[model samples]
Target: MSSPRKTSPGKRMTAGLLVMAGLLLVREFAPESPIAIAALIIGLIALLIIIPAYFRALLSSRRDR
Candidate 1:
C-alpha cells in the first residue's frame, strides 16, 4: 500500500484565487453569457475545495512541526 502525496496549502490558495479572478473576469466581460454563470459555479466549487484543503494542510504541517 502507498500513501497519497500531500499538496501544499499555498498552492491550493493560489489556485483558488486564480479561479476567482478568472470567474470575475468572465462575468465582468460577459455578464449576459452562460459561460459567466458556469464560471461562477465552478469558482464556488474550487473555493469550497481549496479552503478546507488549505486548512487541513496547514494544521497537519503545524502538528508535525
Candidate 2:
C-alpha cells in the first residue's frame, strides 16, 4: 500500500519565507508605486474571495468525515 503524499511543515515555512522575501524586494524597488498599490489591492481581493471558499471547504470536509 502507498501512503498519501504530504508537504512537511518545514517546506511550507520555506515557501512562505521565499514569497515574503520576494514581496519585500518588490516593495523596496518601488515604495509607494502604483504597481505596488495595485498589487496590494489585488492581493486583498484574492484573499477576500479565497478565504470564504477555504472555510467552506474546511467545513464541508469536516462534515463529510
Q: Write the per-residue lDDT of candidate 2 for residues 1-65, one digit (tens) a residue.
A: 99999754444445545555665666778878987776566555555545565566567678879
Ten-residue segment with the worst summed lDDT in candidate 2? 8-17
Give the candidate number with the greatest TM-score: 1
Clashes of 2: 0
Question: How good is model 2 by TM-score?
Answer: 0.52
Q: In candidate 2, which residue pairs clash?
A: none
Query: For residues 10-65, could you state the per-residue lDDT of candidate 1 as single tens digits?
Result: 77888888888889999999999999889989988988978897888789889999
Error of 2 at 50 (Å): 1.7
Indicate the residue-level lDDT of 54 in model 2: 58
lDDT of each: 0.87, 0.61
lDDT of 1 at 42: 94
